[model samples]
Target: MGKDAPYVLVVGAGAVGTYFAARLWQAGARLAMLCRSDYEAVCKHGSFDIKSPHGDFKFIPEAIIKNPSECPVPPDFIIVSTKALPEIDVASLIRPAVHPKTSIVLLQNGIGFDEPLAAAFPGNELISGMTYIGVTRTAPGRIEHIDSGRVALGKFPRGISQNAQLLAGLFAKSSVPCEIHENILAKRWEKLVWNVPFNPISVLSRADTSAIMAHPASRELSRSLMEEVCSIAAVAGFPLQPGIVQKNLDYTAAMKPYKTSMLVDFENKRPMEIEAILGNPLRVAESHGLSVPNMRAIYALIQLLETGCRH
Candidate 1:
């Protein structure tokens, strides 16, 4: 729109990417999206038909590229919102569009996952991001956003920077709540407090949030898992709030019955983020000589579940 408008290239234009891309667009940034599965549909439709409680709108990006190398220009920011599956080498995927000053933003899930990206681009600023939202791509070029869509982000390892603040301001202008944090890793661990319990449990039990909360046995199991995660976080030096487990339970219990992303991936026969969500934290626990038997059991069961489903 202007000579000074920031250029943002979104690497994975899935539901999460599209939603936030739309926000950035609303804040007047120029956008180019590197899309895959929905490329044909999005190209044919000429827009992303986003249906959200916040608002419903259609977004047409400046360019729809099939590869990062096809990016029209080097971007000031590259937002990588891909699933944290081990097989996807995210660092290499966005390398082509990265300029010397490009701020690489990791808008993804899980714990301790930013290390690889930080390692890959030591010179570039790495913004660690965590999004809390209930969203999905119901079909090609279509998104359904049903619940909270807040985000917390900061420079990787620690502290907030100008890039982080600028992006947060853009999201805020678009009316999406975005917080800049001093230590985003702690926030990731905080999110894992919920993800650890609900995500895997949803897949293992074939239950949504409400059903999981309603059942006495499942509820207790979830509580135990949360406690284990809190313990692990504490031992690892990022001690969580005093009543995180119960606080998470209360919030989820009151939430709309919703299928987790992991469950949705399982039903669709896609690879779940088992390693990133469960395995990585478990490894951290082990490094600190902490025992998280509940997480270990759930992690094992989910891994087996994923294996059986894939075959």
Candidate 2:
């Protein structure tokens, strides 16, 4: 990897990882992806097919390795797009690919998700990335980009770095909107205003986002949940803008009928990110002496669902 073109190791090749990896590869970056399930197919096919609103194309990563040990060289940046499940050891997952100068960019959801990783790998740069894209892996080595592909990148805690700017440029070259946010935590909380409600509701109710928003009762419940999250954010010193609740509702209502990631996981009988998405936020709220009844109820219900799935 040269200074002109950095080597990027994408840790997960699921929907979000595949989309971003394809775009980065297309933007002239040398990229390798750690794909467990799709390794055989991606290697044989030499690329993944992507169907997106921007354009349909095939992207072949520089290398598709099943394990980090197979990486020929330490990457300048390690992009982690995996599910933020509690059981997954993220530090161990990226250990082989991390170099002294590596910048770890987390593209997963939820608040307070970066602390453990940051503590594990001290001195290396940590970036917080929040994505607002609707994408799904329809099959092995195949992705369907439904709508809206925008990313918000920022340094952990606060401020922007050259690496973040470079990443934004890479995404921009592929026509993906990537912006730098000084307060990425605030942005994460803002995203929770949408994720906290839609994700779990879709799972429990067995419905898509459009259907959830269409039902009067569910829609009202979603609003209450959003209000609760906003209150927590406010007490935590990251007050969201006024009208964020309505804006999120309107956005989801206008979107195409789509299944939340949690719903997809539940249907596939896979582990959902209940802890990172719900557990951490609830912990923050409790520490701040704030109560979030709606979030607590949904968290409990999802915990039960997850318990059954794991057993």
Candidate 3:
């Protein structure tokens, strides 16, 4: 990632985007960010924070672009790290940045976004990835990593493939731990094992990772939700490991205290990313002729709380 290296485009400068961009820049990649106008502060100050397990440090990228068209050359790679609410609009807007060889890496949460995002750029290379980095946004240009910094990424074993190893190697040199996953879907669903329960529950209950993990009822509720998804995942062929729920809860218990992005949105009276995080899973289950009762309950509660906040 030097002067002659590929110019990697990182879309979304929120928590996940900033965290990876910081690392990508640090690895000597010439990075470009498709950021919102609000993050002009980040562009000007050239100062951003990343709190990782190894340590926390402030970082600045090489260049930041507000508009996709500002980037003259088509990016060799694009990482979509936005909350799902903005992804569809952003995907349609940035179609020109992708050439036949451009690789699209999705870092968003949930299982259902892959196909649609991939379909956006018909022939461009698409690689789906899951980031297990636990991060919270304290402010614009600010992010705190509460727990893990693991990245699972690779080509879709089930479909048309692309430059899988090259991108994996590039990421491995970044700050977080990166692994080339053959079963990328299972990796994504495993991360969902943590998110489907924690995100919505935290938002509705106004609890951080520690709080949701500590309550006996909350712990039970988390397990039940995970089991529901696990059942559906089995039919889809990603048989998740047993005890993953308790393991994620334990992982949360030992981490820095933080509210999730969904919780942050709830508190700020902003729309939650419920459709991708919760609604999508429920939709996927039904498409497969399956029922996910606990997930249904959580989705209902999320709807209610979202209404409560707006009203």
Each model's RMSD to truth, in Å? 1.3, 1.7, 2.9
Candidate 3 residues 4-76, lDDT tens each? 6777888877888888877767766678777785457777777787777767887866667787777666787
lDDT of 2 at 11: 92
**lDDT per residue (tens digit) for residues 1-311 in model 2:** 24468889999899999999899888888889899998898889989999998889998777889999898778889999998988889899899878899999999899877889889888899998988888989989999998888999999877899999999999999888998999988999999999999999999999999999999999999999999999999998999999999999998999889888889889999888888788999998999988889899999999998898789
Better of 1 and 3 by TM-score: 1
TM-score on alpha carbons, each prediction:
0.96, 0.94, 0.87
Pairs clashing within candidate 1:
none
Model 2 — TM-score against the truth?
0.94
Stretches of model 3 off by over 4 angstroms after superposition = 46-62, 86-88, 136-139, 142-147, 157-162, 249-258
Q: Which candidate is the best by TM-score?
A: 1
Q: How many residue pairs clash in each candidate?
A: 0, 0, 0
Cα lDDT for residue 71, candidate 1: 91
